[model samples]
Target: MSAFTESALLKKLSELNTSQQSIQTLSLWLIHHRKHHTIIVQTWQRELQNVAEPKKLTFMYLANDVIQNSKKKGPEYGKEFSNVLPKVFAHIGESCKSDKLLGSLGRILNIWQERGVYDAKTIADYRGRLHKESSSSAAGAAGAHPVAATGNGNGNGTTKTPSDKHSKVTDKSEKREKRKHEERLSKSKRSRTSHHATAATPIVEPAAPAAEPENGHTPPYLPLGEPPEPEELIKALNSIENSASSDALVRERIAKLPPEISEISCISKLEDKEKAKLLANQVNEAVDLLNDYNARLAAEMEQRTKLAAMLRDFQAEQKELLAQAEQRLDEHKKKLAKMLGLQKEIHDHLSNLPDLTQLPDVTGGLAPLPSAGDLFNTLH
Candidate 1:
């Protein structure tokens, strides 16, 4: 189990039969394997989503067991458990949150604190959400935790607590205040810079450029009206390629432009028209490259799919061959036993037969019952 890699564990889990026993086996395997907690949790969570109700329940129970077990390992293990809690909660979703679930989470957090690992932000967020849900669903507008406003030390509110609404409002106001503070700070800095610049030097202005198109859109790099020179097109491609904000899609569109430019630039005395044709050729080459990439990707995916199928088939064939071999060995043993018995019977019959010497010589010339060795030589 300690030697099991993430990929190996995932493959093992995928090959297992869908049964309660297998689920438990996987759970125990996970518990025993302490490394790759993140990978293990992700794989389990994904599989848990598509599983049946019984399996889902089993996984939930397994997660709880892991958490409980981690408690005994002390704080170091508890931190691992704490890291796993978020993924489990995400898998369970809002529907699975209960007092028991919260209590379990709370216990893990407490363990973490005891072990000297003390960040409970995730649990606190979950607890807040849980309280909100409980308050909304209950028959009375009762708060689950705080009923101090009702003048009772015990936490049982008959009416909706203003605290819940107040908290939401406070959060929004805090955000607004923070944003305003940042804006004020930025303005003050700008004002200070302007004051220093005004004292040091005079501000100069530059002429405005020509107006843009009526629609505020620029024409394409190679306009439809006329063919552009190869140099201009290559320059445009370089600008697009080197621009920081250019996305993958844009880069892909001009992928082959650079190489084409280099190749064309190396040739002497080429006409603009010829260069334009080469540019088109390069565009087609880029498209072909893209198609090839896609084809290779598809082929690799198909190979993987076929390999998995072949592996399963090979395992099945191996089992069948082993069973057949066992059966054949059993048949051989039975035949050997039967042959031994027949040989013993023949020996006994030969020994029981009366010696030919004791019989009044049936054939006068025949050697007396030819000793066993002489009979073998005569037969050969």
Candidate 2:
């Protein structure tokens, strides 16, 4: 919400035909002016701390996108993002003011610049200014002390004290020491590059000058070799995952490259230690991928096991039902047999009783029929 958020700047910059002059100037100024960076980073951290989840993410995303775009497109690429750079800087400048916040900003900027997002001239100018400012501040602080600037309180002393002279000498000494350190770094980088050049298969382009690191020392990268960029590495891994097939060719390709080169695409400003760390992370990522694959396999196995158990239960239930049906069928068969036997017995009994009617009917039929008729005739 701070004025540095640069909503207007971001909006205007997002257009196709916005002025580049303002963007170039402002970006350069922001990068070059150490005090402004300090203020901006401090403000940024403070705001980030207080901001809610999605909103905080928005701020981070904006910053990251601006830097990433610049890295991909060039330093002047910020002109394309509307007011993003301005918004980010303004917001940070307005809100953050802690050393911790400043450190965070420094790390973010270092990564961006290292990624080739920053303008060379802008960074050079900024460093020049910083050197000058540091020198001047040290001198001013040493000279402005009441005891150091003035002789005694009596105000009559004319000669400079030893302590005052020592301060000036100390500043010069410090400057010389810094120069020596830079020389050593340059020599070390040269040696490393020469060593790598022997095994280098591809003709690599020279790396651009890197920004000073967090420790105030610039560490040079070893020359580029035949390896994919970090983005490419991740992309390859993702493709492998999405395809759901572990391609042996891809694994072979990754395995052939040294850990340093296989894990990252760009190592322009990375020190050997940083490169090692990145490699370690890549290893860890690979391990995680393997673990995920194993977990999926286990889950599939577990599902199959469940299905098999269900099938077995279903078969057992069917067998029990079949047995019960067979038992009922047997009981019906036995009852059918008994009913047939009873019918047979009844038939036999009726057959045997029928003969008696024929035999007894002869005598009974002859006597009974005539007697009634004769008596009636006589009475008439």
Candidate 3:
């Protein structure tokens, strides 16, 4: 062991009333630290060769603890005293140094602070490089597209096909294509009318307005032209849904209009009292919708709860089954052990009997031993 490691071990031994096993373990650990320190010195001697001062101080601090703990027991612990003191002196001799060790520790601290030890300039540099590469990649991608030169379509950096480019080049070509497609579609549609048109009825356009009365007044009850096509109706609904502020402005304007003026407007023709009644009806409808939604949500939650409970019950049943299987396995093992013991006992009994063939030979051998010469020798 290095002097530093031996000293540390001695100090540790002094601190605690450790058992023999603990002492042995600590000795092994000390040897390991010495080996580690040797490796560290080999790699970092230039940087850390002068770190003896800090290491000495650290050792002293550890030693103090040991000495203090030793004082707690009476001085009659001679073996502990003998074992610790020589190691301590040896450690001090080997590791104690002044300027070199202190300077080394200061340099290490400065380097540690500057470098952040874990991740300082290295991380920042990596991040900067990554960002630069990403921006370059994005610019390259943007440059790859001819469409990027013009702000058409979705403005994504992608090239367009010649046909797609032609479509965008002039409205005349697009209109012509649309008209041709419509003509072809119309022909096919007329041919397959019975099959295709059966899914939905054909919409009938409203007739143009007839000449007004002699006073030039239009009828108040004219329909708004067949209530728009389904696609148009859907688009109108989407626009209304998307334009909440516009909807609110419209509603506000309707609400502020005079009764006669409101009555002239199609959407705001009702009196205040009638509007209030309509609003109350709407609120009631919303409440009913909310209640229905909540009821469905509650039913889903109850189903989830039931499923969780069933899962928990299944887990408990599985655990019980596993425990029963284990119990059965243990019982079988015990029975097998008992049967083995009985078999062993039976074998022992059978092996203890003498062979019948050996009995006569045994009797003859005993008779020859009773001869006169053998008897005289036996008497002596």
- Note the Cα lDDT for every prediction shown: 0.49, 0.44, 0.39
lDDT of 3 by residue, 1-380 (tens): 22344445445534432222232333333323433433322322222223344444333222222222223233222234234434443333334333322222222222323334324553333223322333344456556655654655456655545434332333343244345444644654454444332433222221112112336543211111111224544554454443433445545644554443223353464557887686557556555655565455444443343333344434443454465578678988999999999999999998998877765566445544377988899899
TM of each candidate vs. truth: 0.26, 0.24, 0.18
lDDT of 2 at 101: 33
lDDT: worst 10-residue window of model 2: 219-228
- Residue 178 shift from truth in candidate 1, angstroms: 41
Q: Which candidate is the best by lDDT?
A: 1
lDDT of each residue in 94-118, candidate 2, tens digit only: 4443332332334334444555556
How many residue pairs clash in all the candidates, one count each?
A: 0, 21, 1
**RMSD for each model, in Å, please?**
25.0, 31.9, 33.0
Best by TM-score: 1
Q: Lowest summed lDDT over 10 consecutive residues: which window, candidate 1?
A: 219-228
Candidate 3 residue pairs that clash? 50-101
